[model samples]
Target: MTGKNMKNDIVNKKDLKQLVIRFYGKLREDKILGHFFNHVTPVNWNEHIKMMYGFWENVLFFTGDYSGDPMRKHVAIHKKHPFSLSDFTHWNKLFIETVDEMYKGENAEIIKQRAQSISTIMQIKLFK
Candidate 1:
Protein backbone atom coordinates (compact mmCIF):
# COMPACT_ATOMS: atom_id res chain seq x y z
CA MET A 1 0.00 0.00 0.00
CA THR A 2 1.30 3.39 -1.03
CA GLY A 3 1.41 6.30 1.42
CA LYS A 4 -1.54 8.07 -0.18
CA ASN A 5 -3.62 4.91 -0.19
CA MET A 6 -2.78 4.19 3.42
CA LYS A 7 -3.83 7.70 4.32
CA ASN A 8 -7.11 7.16 2.55
CA ASP A 9 -7.72 3.96 4.46
CA ILE A 10 -7.21 5.68 7.78
CA VAL A 11 -9.49 8.48 6.62
CA ASN A 12 -12.31 6.01 6.14
CA LYS A 13 -15.17 6.46 8.64
CA LYS A 14 -17.41 3.46 8.09
CA ASP A 15 -15.39 1.18 10.33
CA LEU A 16 -16.12 3.38 13.29
CA LYS A 17 -19.81 3.60 12.49
CA GLN A 18 -20.13 -0.11 11.89
CA LEU A 19 -18.47 -0.91 15.19
CA VAL A 20 -20.84 1.44 17.02
CA ILE A 21 -23.94 0.03 15.33
CA ARG A 22 -22.97 -3.58 15.78
CA PHE A 23 -21.87 -3.03 19.36
CA TYR A 24 -25.11 -1.27 20.30
CA GLY A 25 -27.09 -3.62 18.16
CA LYS A 26 -25.78 -6.22 20.58
CA LEU A 27 -26.03 -3.90 23.56
CA ARG A 28 -29.71 -3.47 22.87
CA GLU A 29 -29.91 -7.16 23.66
CA ASP A 30 -27.21 -7.30 26.34
CA LYS A 31 -28.21 -8.19 29.88
CA ILE A 32 -26.13 -5.43 31.46
CA LEU A 33 -26.18 -2.40 29.18
CA GLY A 34 -29.57 -3.10 27.69
CA HIS A 35 -31.55 -2.24 30.77
CA PHE A 36 -29.86 1.13 31.08
CA PHE A 37 -30.98 2.11 27.62
CA ASN A 38 -34.47 2.38 29.03
CA HIS A 39 -33.63 6.01 29.81
CA VAL A 40 -32.22 6.66 26.38
CA THR A 41 -34.17 8.83 23.97
CA PRO A 42 -34.51 5.81 21.69
CA VAL A 43 -35.23 8.15 18.79
CA ASN A 44 -31.61 8.77 17.82
CA TRP A 45 -29.90 5.50 17.17
CA ASN A 46 -28.24 7.03 14.14
CA GLU A 47 -27.13 10.02 16.15
CA HIS A 48 -25.67 7.79 18.79
CA ILE A 49 -23.71 5.91 16.16
CA LYS A 50 -22.29 9.15 14.81
CA MET A 51 -21.34 10.28 18.29
CA MET A 52 -19.53 7.02 18.91
CA TYR A 53 -17.79 7.23 15.56
CA GLY A 54 -16.58 10.72 16.26
CA PHE A 55 -15.47 9.59 19.69
CA TRP A 56 -13.34 6.67 18.50
CA GLU A 57 -12.03 8.62 15.51
CA ASN A 58 -10.85 11.42 17.74
CA VAL A 59 -9.49 9.26 20.52
CA LEU A 60 -7.58 6.98 18.20
CA PHE A 61 -6.52 9.58 15.66
CA PHE A 62 -6.44 12.92 17.46
CA THR A 63 -8.94 14.18 14.91
CA GLY A 64 -10.91 16.20 17.46
CA ASP A 65 -14.28 15.21 16.04
CA TYR A 66 -15.32 14.26 19.53
CA SER A 67 -15.73 17.04 22.07
CA GLY A 68 -16.98 15.29 25.17
CA ASP A 69 -14.83 13.55 27.73
CA PRO A 70 -15.60 9.85 27.61
CA MET A 71 -14.29 9.28 31.13
CA ARG A 72 -16.63 11.89 32.52
CA LYS A 73 -19.54 10.40 30.66
CA HIS A 74 -18.67 6.98 32.02
CA VAL A 75 -18.44 8.42 35.50
CA ALA A 76 -21.91 9.90 35.16
CA ILE A 77 -23.19 6.60 33.91
CA HIS A 78 -21.48 4.95 36.87
CA LYS A 79 -23.26 7.31 39.23
CA LYS A 80 -26.52 5.76 38.15
CA HIS A 81 -25.14 2.23 38.39
CA PRO A 82 -22.05 0.63 39.67
CA PHE A 83 -20.01 -0.37 36.66
CA SER A 84 -17.63 -3.29 37.21
CA LEU A 85 -14.36 -3.97 35.46
CA SER A 86 -15.86 -7.12 34.03
CA ASP A 87 -18.45 -5.06 32.23
CA PHE A 88 -15.80 -2.91 30.56
CA THR A 89 -13.67 -5.92 29.77
CA HIS A 90 -16.62 -7.51 28.08
CA TRP A 91 -17.45 -4.29 26.28
CA ASN A 92 -13.90 -3.97 24.96
CA LYS A 93 -13.95 -7.57 23.84
CA LEU A 94 -17.18 -7.01 21.96
CA PHE A 95 -15.78 -3.85 20.44
CA ILE A 96 -12.63 -5.60 19.29
CA GLU A 97 -14.60 -8.51 17.95
CA THR A 98 -16.83 -6.23 15.94
CA VAL A 99 -13.87 -4.38 14.49
CA ASP A 100 -12.07 -7.60 13.67
CA GLU A 101 -15.14 -9.06 12.03
CA MET A 102 -15.50 -5.92 9.91
CA TYR A 103 -12.00 -4.85 8.96
CA LYS A 104 -8.57 -6.42 8.94
CA GLY A 105 -5.61 -4.07 9.12
CA GLU A 106 -3.05 -2.39 11.31
CA ASN A 107 -5.51 0.40 12.03
CA ALA A 108 -7.90 -2.14 13.47
CA GLU A 109 -5.21 -3.20 15.90
CA ILE A 110 -4.61 0.43 16.84
CA ILE A 111 -8.30 0.92 17.52
CA LYS A 112 -8.43 -2.26 19.56
CA GLN A 113 -5.50 -1.24 21.71
CA ARG A 114 -6.96 2.19 22.28
CA ALA A 115 -10.32 0.73 23.18
CA GLN A 116 -8.72 -1.68 25.63
CA SER A 117 -6.64 1.08 27.15
CA ILE A 118 -9.68 3.30 27.51
CA SER A 119 -11.69 0.52 29.07
CA THR A 120 -8.91 -0.40 31.46
CA ILE A 121 -8.42 3.19 32.53
CA MET A 122 -12.11 3.71 32.99
CA GLN A 123 -12.42 0.48 34.89
CA ILE A 124 -9.69 1.46 37.29
CA LYS A 125 -11.19 4.90 37.81
CA LEU A 126 -14.68 3.55 38.32
CA PHE A 127 -13.37 1.11 40.89
CA LYS A 128 -11.45 3.78 42.74
Candidate 2:
Protein backbone atom coordinates (compact mmCIF):
# COMPACT_ATOMS: atom_id res chain seq x y z
CA MET A 1 0.00 0.00 0.00
CA THR A 2 1.37 3.40 -0.93
CA GLY A 3 0.96 6.53 1.20
CA LYS A 4 -1.00 8.32 -1.52
CA ASN A 5 -3.63 5.58 -1.75
CA MET A 6 -3.91 4.97 1.99
CA LYS A 7 -7.03 7.07 2.27
CA ASN A 8 -8.94 4.53 0.20
CA ASP A 9 -8.62 1.87 2.85
CA ILE A 10 -12.01 2.27 4.41
CA VAL A 11 -13.57 -0.04 6.99
CA ASN A 12 -16.87 -1.68 6.29
CA LYS A 13 -19.62 -2.39 8.83
CA LYS A 14 -18.77 -6.09 8.87
CA ASP A 15 -15.22 -5.32 9.89
CA LEU A 16 -16.42 -3.00 12.62
CA LYS A 17 -18.77 -5.65 13.97
CA GLN A 18 -16.01 -8.23 14.02
CA LEU A 19 -13.72 -5.82 15.85
CA VAL A 20 -16.36 -5.13 18.49
CA ILE A 21 -17.01 -8.82 19.07
CA ARG A 22 -13.36 -9.74 19.22
CA PHE A 23 -12.43 -6.84 21.49
CA TYR A 24 -15.20 -7.72 23.94
CA GLY A 25 -14.08 -11.32 23.83
CA LYS A 26 -10.69 -10.16 25.07
CA LEU A 27 -12.25 -7.86 27.65
CA ARG A 28 -14.33 -10.71 29.04
CA GLU A 29 -11.19 -12.60 29.97
CA ASP A 30 -8.92 -9.65 30.75
CA LYS A 31 -7.49 -9.65 34.26
CA ILE A 32 -7.93 -5.93 34.87
CA LEU A 33 -11.18 -5.25 33.02
CA GLY A 34 -13.03 -8.53 33.09
CA HIS A 35 -14.69 -7.97 36.41
CA PHE A 36 -16.49 -4.90 35.22
CA PHE A 37 -18.23 -6.73 32.44
CA ASN A 38 -18.48 -10.21 33.89
CA HIS A 39 -19.19 -9.52 37.55
CA VAL A 40 -19.79 -5.86 38.32
CA THR A 41 -22.39 -5.10 35.70
CA PRO A 42 -23.06 -8.70 34.72
CA VAL A 43 -23.54 -7.59 31.17
CA ASN A 44 -26.10 -8.93 28.79
CA TRP A 45 -23.48 -9.66 26.21
CA ASN A 46 -25.82 -9.98 23.26
CA GLU A 47 -27.44 -6.61 23.83
CA HIS A 48 -24.20 -4.89 24.73
CA ILE A 49 -22.34 -6.24 21.72
CA LYS A 50 -25.17 -5.27 19.42
CA MET A 51 -25.14 -1.77 20.77
CA MET A 52 -21.39 -1.55 20.44
CA TYR A 53 -21.59 -2.66 16.81
CA GLY A 54 -23.95 0.18 16.12
CA PHE A 55 -21.83 2.62 18.07
CA TRP A 56 -18.61 1.81 16.27
CA GLU A 57 -20.30 1.70 12.90
CA ASN A 58 -21.69 5.15 13.55
CA VAL A 59 -18.35 6.40 14.79
CA LEU A 60 -16.24 5.05 11.94
CA PHE A 61 -18.58 5.13 8.98
CA PHE A 62 -20.90 7.97 9.97
CA THR A 63 -23.84 5.58 9.74
CA GLY A 64 -25.63 7.45 12.53
CA ASP A 65 -27.02 4.30 14.09
CA TYR A 66 -26.02 4.93 17.67
CA SER A 67 -28.04 7.37 19.77
CA GLY A 68 -27.24 6.95 23.42
CA ASP A 69 -25.34 9.02 25.93
CA PRO A 70 -22.08 7.09 26.25
CA MET A 71 -20.63 9.60 28.70
CA ARG A 72 -23.58 9.27 31.01
CA LYS A 73 -23.32 5.52 30.88
CA HIS A 74 -19.64 5.58 31.69
CA VAL A 75 -20.21 8.10 34.47
CA ALA A 76 -22.74 5.81 36.11
CA ILE A 77 -20.33 2.91 35.83
CA HIS A 78 -17.54 5.02 37.29
CA LYS A 79 -19.71 6.03 40.22
CA LYS A 80 -20.01 2.40 41.07
CA HIS A 81 -16.35 1.37 40.64
CA PRO A 82 -14.21 4.48 40.33
CA PHE A 83 -12.07 3.94 37.21
CA SER A 84 -8.58 5.41 37.37
CA LEU A 85 -6.19 6.60 34.71
CA SER A 86 -4.57 3.19 34.65
CA ASP A 87 -7.87 1.64 33.69
CA PHE A 88 -8.31 4.01 30.82
CA THR A 89 -4.73 3.47 29.80
CA HIS A 90 -5.17 -0.26 29.81
CA TRP A 91 -8.41 -0.03 27.89
CA ASN A 92 -6.84 2.12 25.22
CA LYS A 93 -3.86 -0.17 25.03
CA LEU A 94 -6.04 -3.20 24.51
CA PHE A 95 -8.12 -1.33 21.95
CA ILE A 96 -5.05 -0.35 19.98
CA GLU A 97 -3.75 -3.88 20.14
CA THR A 98 -7.03 -5.24 18.87
CA VAL A 99 -7.22 -2.75 16.01
CA ASP A 100 -3.61 -3.27 15.02
CA GLU A 101 -3.96 -7.03 15.05
CA MET A 102 -6.91 -6.91 12.69
CA TYR A 103 -6.26 -3.96 10.40
CA LYS A 104 -3.65 -1.65 8.94
CA GLY A 105 -5.33 1.20 7.19
CA GLU A 106 -6.61 4.72 7.55
CA ASN A 107 -9.84 3.62 9.26
CA ALA A 108 -7.88 1.43 11.65
CA GLU A 109 -5.64 4.37 12.55
CA ILE A 110 -8.66 6.59 12.95
CA ILE A 111 -10.31 4.07 15.24
CA LYS A 112 -7.30 3.86 17.51
CA GLN A 113 -6.94 7.62 17.62
CA ARG A 114 -10.61 8.01 18.45
CA ALA A 115 -10.36 5.42 21.19
CA GLN A 116 -7.42 7.26 22.75
CA SER A 117 -9.27 10.54 22.62
CA ILE A 118 -12.38 8.97 24.08
CA SER A 119 -10.41 7.33 26.87
CA THR A 120 -8.72 10.60 27.76
CA ILE A 121 -11.99 12.48 27.76
CA MET A 122 -13.64 9.84 29.91
CA GLN A 123 -10.81 9.90 32.39
CA ILE A 124 -11.02 13.65 32.73
CA LYS A 125 -14.77 13.61 33.13
CA LEU A 126 -14.89 10.68 35.53
CA PHE A 127 -11.79 11.26 37.61
CA LYS A 128 -11.37 15.03 37.55
Please give each candidate's TM-score: 0.79, 0.89
Give candidate 1's total backbone clashes. Answer: 0
Tens-digit per-residue lDDT, 1-128, candidate 2: 67664433335887888889999999988999999998777899999899988888877887857899999988888888878788788999899988877777889989888878877888888877
Q: Flag regions of model 1 displaced more than 4 Å.
A: 1-11, 40-43
Best by TM-score: 2
Q: How close is candidate 1 to the true structure, as a TM-score?
A: 0.79
> Where does candidate 2 stray beyond 4 Å?
1-10
| lDDT values for all models | 0.71, 0.84
- TM-score of candidate 2 relative to the true fold: 0.89
Per-residue alpha-carbon lDDT of model 1 for 89-119, expressed as tens digits?
A: 7787777777777666778778888878877
* Candidate 2 colliding pairs, count: 0
RMSD of 2: 3.8
